[model samples]
Target: MTETHAWKAEDFAQVNAPHVKTALTALQLTGDALEQGGAFAEIGCGTGEVARFVAERGFEVWASDASQSMVEATGKLCDGLPVTAEVCPAEQLEFPEGRFGVIHSSWVLHWVTEIDEPLRRMARGLRPGGYIVLQWTGAHPRSEGPGMFGILRDIAGSPKWKDLLAEAQPGSYEYPAEEVAKVLEEAGLELVHYEPDLPHPFSAKKTMADLPEMRERYKLAGFATQAAALGDRGDEFVDEVLTAMIRAGKTDPHHARIVARRPAA
Candidate 1:
């Protein structure tokens, strides 16, 4: 499960506003399963921006995330709004069967390791005609290997941080559209839309040009081991990783998107 304490809610909200906005736009194109008396649900709701936005659309929204800080932030963002925020991991989500019209997750899916269980759970939560819109990618949507996590690991294994981050297991996994489709199929969700390397708003990916800021992001994004081990020193290590990413042009990553639905029958 993605660690919660390492996340900075405000920081995440600032960097990922575009992603939530894009997800909201995709949800707008989805079918009207909510008309069947099902509410809208968002998995991995970082700061609850999507929940707030959707609630404003006049739908009761249920949102969850593994991070308690994130969940709390969601509550703050959607205060007095028709939204319910909870602290739950995607894999352990226990929504009532057929309770949601749309189950959405944006930049959150890539961090998940137990992919099948989460997909299965989300599928179970969907109403018969309900849909799920997912956005994810591999490393940089354009690159073949070694994303931010790999860079962090490489820096951790270097001479300077090798001993300091010895127990650091920092890694982020983003999957491709085809891979996501296969998982959705395995979970019994019929594919509706597939956009590979979706470039539109996804181009809003955080660039690697700002080394210090990027390092701050890297450390705060579930790098508990490194943070606990080196404390303030982790910043230097993250800077080196960011420098390497800049050198390799791993600046603008995109995400592949897929929209799928449960069978109406």
Candidate 2:
């Protein structure tokens, strides 16, 4: 599955505010741990929402994403702000060593096939005493066990989707907070704060109430990648999955947040 095409820029832009809000909260929690006015970078900066928030706070922001449309959208959204947007994949990230004091990524790292290299690069990109803030979906709601993807795996059953899910087992990773902290520690970062589970930023009841529109948005944003994995049958597959999710009253997946710091020299 082409990572870039999995999410449409316009569709993602619509539901981006809540995520930006969460990332902003994480940034605020970092507080004085980050050097004031220091360089900041966001990986997978879809639509530039978080970058805009950071730039508006007077930080020089650099953001990158695999999707060109997202990069372009970010550029336009951040126009006139202290921000730069580039088209780059996580594995290809190339930042100067010890260049940034704050690095942020939201709902992005799991997409990368390999986490170690990019993580090592992120660690290297931070200046001593820098802060690295990350957020990603940790696990699916037990209530929705197998949820939408379960239907896909059973019906469509494409090898690509299977492999993608198989790599991490299930569509999304639910890394334990301790494991994530250990990964950071191995990369020479000290854990400052960790939230293993955060409340879903959106309301499931409201989403279910507006099931049709929500399904459309999900088709464009969340299921696009899955659709791409399904090829010609993608649309039908997504429709069925969304219908199932609505019927099952599945809530949004839980998220994990981590704030770690590179030790002072």
Candidate 3:
């Protein structure tokens, strides 16, 4: 249920390119997945930056997004690369069984209601011994504790965020490591790696690095319909939260990241 609002390629490219690169570097994929060479799929291929990155390293890439504009933009970005782009939900992917050597999704899984079905699909889509890598924002990803949300709530007051906090309730997505291992096992994926890492810090003043940006991303992600329903007031709430976050960053930085992998064999 990711939001869609005529997103342009530039918007995503601007917001994620740096962060994605940082995440990718931290993952240290080492081009092993790319070397497998059957098909590599990236779920939530916003602007196709990560897809293109892997494509350049030699994987024949297949990428999809729920957003039509994002799909179109991703296609344009992968215009000449060895990548194919589609607009579809993870649950509806139409590739033949065992078609991919690698599957990837970056910063998008938090929007999912439950990852079991999609992970099942991904496991089914992989060739024997294929790899799956996912990088996403967790409760603490990109922020310290309650991270940016704490700042936003402080400035905007409790009323504005009460609804969002409820919607963003913990464990709605991104299971704890043990739970993730269980989900993968249930989905027929062998857990090869599961690690949590702190993400690079963001500056509200320098990069609009605050809760409003975070909320807008979630709104576009379509998972925050309840929060979006709050409308302009929701936006104002974000601003207030950002203001508070900026003040806090002046005192301490926030960090957030969740990285994991499954190898199908």
Candidate 4:
């Protein structure tokens, strides 16, 4: 798999604001948290919009991401904005125990195959009663039927590719709030709130909140590499997938948000 993405620091301009809105809505952040001394951290803070939003709300913000491009972009976006940007992956954070009043993540935890370890690490970093707000893709099919990956597999005549994706963990664990709460409780986090029905479009015409972050995700999910391998038929393959998504998004929507908190000791 190609670890580095062909993306620019400025390309994230499309995604920052919408994600900031989503994070703020999910966090239910109040003006009270805007007071001085409130500390907040965002994992996978691309381009630093969310960090700036929290910082503006009066919380000291720490933004981090694994991608150097993302980290650099975030630093530039948050420059002179009372925010700290760093290159840190969710699994390993360099911070003292119980340092943050709020821990927020946007469309990040899912990329982590080992979800539990990161949650444990986050728990260790959160102050008691601090909230962890997350907006992520849930278990849902991209298309009405077999999905784009399935179509690509058929076109390329490869059973292995189909099997790999079919076996891939569905977009998410697809558990309800109580189920998520159980996981959090076991990890020493108290269940505060979880809602898995936030509907967002996979693709949209404008770059406004109408579009979910799936535009970049689909390409990054090895689709671009596979398309390149498909040779001359790549253009047709992408068109077919996009046509299907346009049709599906008209009738079905797929997106969600989940929030939990570390208990006060």
Q: Top model by lDDT, which number?
A: 2
The count of backbone overlaps in candidate 1 is 0
In candidate 2 the C-alpha lDDT for residue 50 amounts to: 82
Summarize candidate 2's per-residue lDDT along 55-109 as a digit string, tens digits: 8877899999988889889999999999989888887898799999899998886
Candidate 2 stretches with Cα past 4 Å from truth are 1-3, 33-35, 139-174, 202-213, 227-235, 243-252
What lDDT tens digits, residue by residue, belong to model 1 across residues 44-88? 888887888778777799998878888899999899998999888
Measured with C-alpha atoms, the lDDT of residue 153 in candidate 2 is 47
> Superposing all C-alpha atoms, what RMSD in Å does each candidate have to the true structure?
3.4, 4.5, 5.8, 6.0
What lDDT score belongs to each candidate, Candidate 1 first? 0.72, 0.73, 0.58, 0.59
Which regions of candidate 1 deviate over 4 angstroms? Answer: 1-5, 31-37, 139-143, 166-168, 200-229, 252-254
Among residues 3 or more apart in sequence or in different chains, the pairs in candidate 1 whose N, CA or C atoms overlap within 3 Å are none
Question: What TM-score, over all chains together, does every model reach?
Answer: 0.82, 0.79, 0.67, 0.69
**Candidate 3: global Cα-lDDT?**
0.58
| Candidate 3, residue 31: how far the Cα is off, in Å | 5.8
lDDT of 2 at 24: 79
Candidate 4 ranges with C-alpha deviation above 4 Å: 1-7, 29-31, 34-36, 139-180, 201-237, 243-253
- Tens-digit per-residue lDDT, 70-131, candidate 4: 78887777777778887766666755689988888876664454566677777777787777
